[model samples]
Structures are given as C-alpha cells and as structure tokens.
Target: MAGPLPDGDQAPVDGLLSLEEIKGSEARTFHAYVHIPFCKDICGYCDFNTYTATQLGSLKQSDYAASLISEIRFSAQALEQSKLLPRKFSTVFFGGGTPSLLPAADLIEILSSLEQTFGFTENAEITTEANPDTVTFEKFAALRQAGFNRVSIGMQSGVQSVLDTLERSHNPENVFKAFEIVKGLGFGTSLDLIFGAPGESLEQWRESLEAAIALEPDHLSAYSLIVEPGTKLARQIKSGELAEPDEDLQAEKYELTEQLLSAAGYTWYEISNWSKSESLQSDHNLAYWMGQDWWGYGPGAHSHLGSVRWWNQKHPLSYSKKLEDKISPAVGRELLSIDTAKLERVMLESRTSKGMSISDLEQLEAGAKSRIPQLIADGLIDGQLAIKGRLVLTLRGRLLADAVVRELTD
Candidate 1:
C-alpha cells in the first residue's frame, strides 16, 4: 500500500471530458499504461501502490486481466464521446507490483484488448516490467509473440547483502538467467538498479554497476534509493536498526555511475537513465516528460490529457467496483492553468539531455530569461548550450537540479 492520494476535485462518474480539456488532444502523442498492483512480496523500501496476496481481499489475480480490459474499453469510449480525434497508441507500458507475476496468457489478453480498442502505431513500443525470479523462457517467448518488444527487469542490486537490506526476494543469479532469456527472445532489454541503500558501500555500488554493464542491456536506469515516509525502510532507520544513507556517499556513488556508464558508451538521456544510443531511450517515459497524453489504468494509476490530470482509486476493490458498474475509476482530478502548465513544462524538460527551449522559459516570466546568464556563470547550466538557445544541465546542475528549477521558475 502507498500513502494517501493528493487533494483534488471529485471526478465525474461518466468520466466525461470538457471540450476545453480535449482541445488539441489529437496533436499530442498518445500512450497507454497498465498498472498491475499485485506482488508476491512487498519490498521494504517500496511505496508504490502494490499489494500482496493477503492484502488483496476480494480481488483475485486470476480475474485481474478482465478488469483491466474493461477499463481499456471504457477509456476508448470516453475519448470517442469527448470527440477527441482518435489516435493509435504510440507506446504501451505494463508497470507495477510485478507485472510478470501474472500468467503470460493474461498479459496477452489485456494487450489484445488495447489493440482491439485503439490500434497501435507502426512498430510501437510495448514494454512490461518483470521481476527476475518470476520470468521464464517460455513466458518471454509468449510475450514476444504477442507484441511485447521490451522487458525491464528489477535487478535492484548485484550484492546479496544489499538485497537483504532492501528485502528483495529475488535471487541475484536469477537476474543473469532472466537477462539471457529476454535477450535470446530478441526483446529490448533493460535492467533497473538502485544505489545508496542504507548498508550499501561505494564498492558494493561499483560491483552492481559493473555486473549490469557486463550484461550489455540496451537501456539501463540507475536510481538512487529514496526512503519515503511510512515505508518499512524508513521505520528501520528511525529505530536505529539501519543507518540512514549518507548524502555525501550517495553523491560519490552517483559520480561513479556517470563515469563507468559513460566509459561503457552509454549516454545519459534523462538524469537517471542511460542508453547505448538515442533510439534505445525509453520513449514511454519521454512521453511523460514531453507533456504528451497518456491514460494510466489500474488501482492508484495517474493519467494526463491536455491540461487535465486525474488518478484512479488506490484500493483494488474500489477501482474494480467502479469499473464493474460501468463507471470511471478515477477518484479525483485537477485542471491546470496556463501559467502552471508552462512552469511544469520547464520543470520536466529541464531533467532531460535534450534540454528545454529558452523561448519556452522566457514565456514563463520576464526574470526567467535573465537567470540564464547567472546560471551559466555559476557553472550550473552549459554556457555553450545557452548560446545555442537551449538550457542544458552540466554535471553540477544535475546534482542540484532543484535549485536550477527554482532559479528559472522563481
């Protein structure tokens, strides 16, 4: 389970979208996200909306696919009724509490429904997140045949001690086997790594990086561990059972990550993401940063269209019940104002290697344009890129990304 949802206006039962909300929606690239909320075991550090077998009281894993399909059909109908121009899905990502835990047949069924509702673009990317221990060769083959072209494995760490501290149930060796399976199936492979665990040392982080690099994944995302409040990891640290992660040590590990991955020919696209080439970057993630339209379906899933943002009910039962009654599962929504939308665009685009356009920033406010020179002088943004009309972050800027955002937005 995760924390409470943010405050917002109540959503309509019919899931109707105002004309203002759907205006120009066709021009934006559309994507679909299916959130699987079931997990075999909950990680101590996880705060994502996820549930164990016992936690899901009335929701059976066997019937989960059917429920998701209903939402897909409902979404298509809502968009049609809104008179939003129909567009094929550019990418579909199945993320969650361990999407691989479901039967391959179930995953295939859900994806088939999406296609039948709204066809996919040519060579559109379809990806699913897998727990290394939960995937098999047969499963990968089935998924690949069903049009899932990518698999992101949750490798977490290469060291067993760090794995234990994180409460990850998968064996480290399973990661190697899983990687082999996906690669053999011709799926675009990605491995996710978490550094800065409480007990994790710099050397341990290095070993994890080296292990992942040796596997030669097409895309790799290495994220620093964040101990969200109310998580088991946070409680352990509070009780002195685990030492809190040191900020200085985390910085050192981040620098090492940039060094080794760069040496291996992986370019940093987003601050936390690296890829062997530009084509290998995760297009689904980029869609979000670029302010494109996407509908996230499942418990606690969030969706955005034009300037309107909404989230579904957090509990599986509540989400399923709403859909069962032929109603939208969304619990709340917020419509963004023009200025707020522009500010958000700057905030998100700033984290990417492509950088935000200076013209867009200048539109936010008068002082925003003037901040560029001082930012370059302070060694935060690239002076060369600024001269070319883009605000790109240097290494220091990446580390202090929040301050950089404040400098321009304030």
Candidate 2:
C-alpha cells in the first residue's frame, strides 16, 4: 500500500513516499534511472519491455516526453522532501529499448528539468544507452550540452555476421562510427559486448574483443547470452534454428574476455562490468547492485524503494493514457516485509564485489547464519570486512553469485 500524501503532492501509497517527496529526495545524493521504451526493432534475444518503430510512432514521442517531464517534476519534489541525503545527484542514467532514438532536444529538455527540479552534483555522472545506427555527431554534441558526461554504446559484437545473427541493425562499422562520434563529443564512453551467440566461433569472438579494445572505451560490459523464457530467441532455440553456446565454450569465452580486458587495463568492478579507471565505473548500476533505492520511469519501467517494488504497464497505449490522466502509472507491485528486506540486501550484496555488512546480515533470519561457513569453505563467498560496513564477495565468489544469494536467503 502507498503512504499518505503530504501537502501539495500527489497522493502517496501507505509505505512509499508521496510523489512530491520522491522528487525532493531525488535531488539529494541518489541515482535517477529514466527509461525510454522505444526501439527500432526488438532483438530476438531481448525480453525487456520494448516496442518497435510502428508502436513507437503511434505513441506520440512529443506527448510522452511531456508526460515524462511531469513525472520527473513530481519525483524531484518528492525526493527533495524525503531528504534521503544532503547532497545532489551522484548519477543519472537514460536506459531503455533504445534511448538513442530520442531527439537531442527532447533529451535536453529532460535534463534541464532534472537540473531545475533536483540539482545535480558538480561532476555528476550522467549516462545514456545508445545504439550505433541511431547516433549522429550533432545529436551527440547536443547530448553533451544536455549534461550527459557518459555514453554507453551497445556494440553487442564487432563481427558483422554476429551482429546479423543477433538481429542488430548496425554493422561493425556503424558501431565504430558511433563510438568515435561520442568520444569526439568529449564524453566518457563504454561499450556493451556479448559472447556465446548462436553460431559464433571463438576466433570471431576474439576478433570482436580486439575490435572493441581498439576503440579504447573508458569502460566495458561483457555479458554472456542468456536465454530467458518468452523471448523470440528462446522460441528459435526450441525450433532448432538457434543453438545456445555450450557451457564449456561459454566459460572459455568468459575467461578470454577477462584476460583481454584486464590486460588492456580495465578493472572488473562487478561480474560483467569493467572500467579503465575507478571513476569511469557506472555509479547508477552499482547503486542497484548495492541494494539502494531508485525510481524507474517510462512504460514498463521498474522501481524499488524500501522493499516496495513496482512496475508500470508495458503497452504504450495504456501508459500514454495513464500519463495523460496525471495518475501514477503503476501496473504491478510487491510489498516486502522486514524479513524480506533483510533477505534482499543479503542476496543482492552477494552478487557484487562488495559483500553484505554483518550488521545487515544479522538482521536476517537467525537460521541463515549456519549456512555462511559452508559457503565460505566451498569457495562460494569470502569472510566479512567493512568496506561499506561489512564483508563482500571475493572474485571467485562472484562467479556463483546468484546461487550463493539463493542459498543465503533460502
């Protein structure tokens, strides 16, 4: 249930802050995650709530932008009132089906509203996800002017064949061009590369790695392909037209990625993300991995706050109507009890290099402690130290993070 509304703010749920409070709290030192649900086309392997060009066009980008701004204004006020922290934002992220497709002017308007509603830190890290085909130098320049200091290009792979197999519109050359343009705009840049696509060879993967490294991005995110249920790729795999990479091959590829990127001076801050410098790391994502609360906006965007997680309707039509009515567009929600919160913190912390604080762990069910030593002995986790208050995951532990977290919570 939502909390009571404060004066002059949107009505709040029983436990969550009022919409106005969310805005004010946003102004403080926290992360802002805005979602853009439009994409040129949804990839077979993708399952995130996304719409193709046809659906996006019908949704009216201008109208949606206006609604999004209103949402921003509301959250900014709520954040300031919540007083989560004394400082301004540490990071802001524009992620989505394809944030790059939005015009620079729209992005600028959003950024300006963010600044006016909730102040940004002097050196705030603002990042937007970009696809190669949609990028242009002029757009990038406008993005830089709009206060975006970081650009994350979704390269997926540098091999044209691999790109085609993944149903990506852009070729390797397009990726390169996008990266060069973003870099020339003076923003810190990162690349997203994936391994274990159907029919990809180890040599081809290595070449992809080499190509990505040649671009000299400040950060890199290498993810192994995952076959989630209900995705088109999963259906193809079931139909025998697609083959998931064998475990052994995928493991080898993973090792190769670690070796190559580390040799190139990138530090593995998390399981999938690597940064050339500590400062180049993605603060917004780290916040999520560390179990901090964040707001998510846009059709089908998800949010988590104080153990209350919620998501909006996925269909653009439904989302547009809700936004026009000035109502909170939540379509689903889960309210966690105190025990669940403790369990979540423990589970989430295990996935990152930063382990959970013992004090926080003590808050978990007493029976959960008996499993800790076994996990540590089995090389599934390391002992506690106080980085952010207690112990964190060791490099080896990170490999089996999800299973270990499940064990702790179960």
Candidate 3:
C-alpha cells in the first residue's frame, strides 16, 4: 500500500465547489475527462483501475452506466446553478481500461447526457480510447454520430509473439483492420505502440513503428514498457521470468522513435505523443501538461481544480454503491501549495514543445536551481525556464524525460 502523503492526514474540505468555481480561474481552455474502468479482458501488465468482465458482471456494468449519467447530472446542475459554464470547450476525452467495450447505445446515452448537461463548443475535439478487439465499423460510426471526432486505438506491437508475451488480446491484423475502418469512416485517429517488451528485438520495435506510420494516423503515441509495482509484470521481473531492456538500449529505441516520427512529418508535441500538425494535437491531454482544470467521473478517475487534485474510489461496485447512497466516492485528495504547483507546471511544460518559462522555475528553492545547471550541461533543458522565457527539452533531453521531471519534483 502507498504510505501517507507528505502531509500527515487526509481530510475533506468543508464543501465541494461547483464546476464553475473550479474552472473560473483558468483561462486557457475548458476540457473534461470521463473515465470508464470496464474491460472485456485484463492485460497482465496493466496497473490501471480496471477490472475484467467476470469481475464487473453484467448488472454491475449496467449500474455503472446509470451512475455515470447521474454524476454528470449532478455536476451539470452544480455548474448551471453557479452560472459558470464556459462559452466554449476545447476538448472532451473518454479514457478508460477499454471504453470501446461499451455498446453503442450506452455510449450514445452518455454523450447525450454530457451534451444536455454542459453544452459543447461549436467545434470541439472529442476523443475516445479503444483496444483493437473492441473496435467495429458500426460502433465507430455510432461514436462519430454521438460527437466523437477522434479515436485513439491501442496497438502495442505488430508481431504476434510480442502481443502474446505482453498478454495483449489483439493481433496485428486486428490493428490494421481497425485502422482501415476508422480511416474509411473519416475520423481523426491516433495509434499507440509500446516498445522494449521482454525478448523484443530492436528490429521488431522498428517494425512496430513502421506499421503505425504506414496507417498514416493523425497522431501517434509511443511508450517504453514500465513494470509497475503490484502488477503481474513486476512480479514476473522479481521472479526472474522477465527482464526489461537496459537503460542504454531503451534510450536508443527512444531516439529511433523521435527520428523516424519526425522524418515521417509528425510533430513531437509532447515527450511521448506526436501529431501530424498543430491541429492534430490532443487538446484534452494538453490541458493536463499545461495545468488546466478538468472534471472526471467513474472508478479511479482523477480530477484537477487549480492546485487541488482528487481521485474517486477504485472499486466499481463500491463506486456505484456510494453514489446510490448519495455520498462522494472520492478516495484521495491533495491540495498543492502554490510553490509545488508551479514546480510541477514547469516540469511538465519543459517536456513539450510549448516549453516551460523561467518565472515558473524561480519559485523553486535555491537548491533546486543550483541543481539544474548539470541538467542544462547534459542537454536535458535549454536555458533557464523562468516564467517569461519558454525553454523546451532538446531531443536528447526527452529521452530521459521522466528522470528530469523526477529530479525537479523529488
């Protein structure tokens, strides 16, 4: 179990504010995140707050759908009463263990509720995440009709052995089929690929990238395999059944990804996300790296209101039961001090093309600033990122993005 935070105890605030009160101070862009924790099957490597079909059961899934709509209604009522709905919303993201597993009717009802509760902007970037096995032309069409303009498909590899080793359900053909269907339907699409699985060769990793690019997706996201504590993958590593690629090898793969994607005309907008052009970037994710407010619902969903970050309970049944009992189901919450928030914003922005400013970093302690010189010398960051000057990561810097961010925060 995770230990207590730096602060000794967890305490609830006197009252929860309406969505308007939460978002009013942020002027950048208005966005929302909806978390769906249901999946047909659970991958062994996943550590997300999700469960398999047997664990969720059919009745529980139905109840979850209703509960989510109710949460939206409650939040919408709060926003309306406060008169704080923004004139426009830049993005709406439906993220999950496998959002695609939900039926078209269920998805349509959810979207309808959101449209009724908080109106969308004239041209909103609405996106949904799905695994290949769950995708279908009919469902894709229904999603488009329901206001989802973009779809993000997860395809970890182009090789069957890699998929089997990772315990991923989809094959390469499924990924290609899903891509073709989404493209034929004319929706902006993004593909996800994971590199450095145990026993995966550099040539195989390169093949995965080539396959993703061949699809000509509007956006692409690449991640290095990470073994989270408590995950099956972690246990496998501990038992000597699996081993991650060495740091030097992983760095080489990341460099190859950057070079290949950049050459393929994709802009490296964030450390792991690449887009075809300015318009193809994921606005909802940008809201996060830029430290903007967003509201979320469902099991294990997290939300940010200014410097306050909170997460809902993880168990689906418990989440629905709490909502049915008319009580907040949140399990954890944190209110960041201004200094901490500024430091986090700087660290996040530094990994992207938008860059971090010098003013943001100055808020850190003198010791933190003193430690940054070596990072600059190592090419992890370009000049001082004061609030006024935007300093972004160089290609070499992005390869060790997590390490750079950790040094700042730790």
**lDDT by residue (tens digit), candidate 3, 1-410:** 12122332242422265453355444656677887887877776887877887887654666567989877766565445555544345688888888888887887788778877677878888888989988899999988877888989999899889899899988999999999888888889999898888888888888989989999999999988887778887888789898865778888889899888999999999989999999899888888898787778777777666556777667778778767776666667777776777667767777788875554564553455665677788888776543236557778878877787777666
| Candidate 2 error regions (>4 Å) | 1-28, 76-87, 362-373, 382-396
TM-score for candidate 1, residues paired by index: 0.99
Candidate ranking under TM-score, highest first, comes to 1, 3, 2
Residue 241 displacement (Å), model 2: 0.8
| Residue 310 in candidate 2, Cα distance off native in Å | 2.3
* Global Cα lDDT for candidate 1: 0.92
lDDT of 2 at 407: 77
What's the distance in Å from true for residue 51, model 2?
0.9
Question: lDDT for every model?
Answer: 0.92, 0.76, 0.77
Per-residue lDDT over 1-410 for candidate 1, one digit per residue giving the tens place of the 0 to 100 score: 25788789998988889898887688899999999998998999999999999998867999889889999999999988888888999999999989999999999999999999899999899999999999899988999999999999999999999999999988789999999999999999999999999989999999999999999999999999998999999999999999999988988998999999999999998899999999999999999999999999999999999779999999889998999999999999999888788878888999999998898788776679888899899899999998999999998898889899988888
TM-score of 3: 0.90
Question: Which pairs of residues collide in model 3?
Answer: 357-385, 357-386, 358-385, 358-386, 358-387, 359-386, 359-387
* Position 273, candidate 3: lDDT: 93
Cα RMSD (angstroms) for every candidate in the order listed: 1.0, 5.1, 3.3
Ten-residue region with minimum lDDT total, candidate 3: 1-10
| Per-candidate TM-score against the hidden true structure | 0.99, 0.87, 0.90
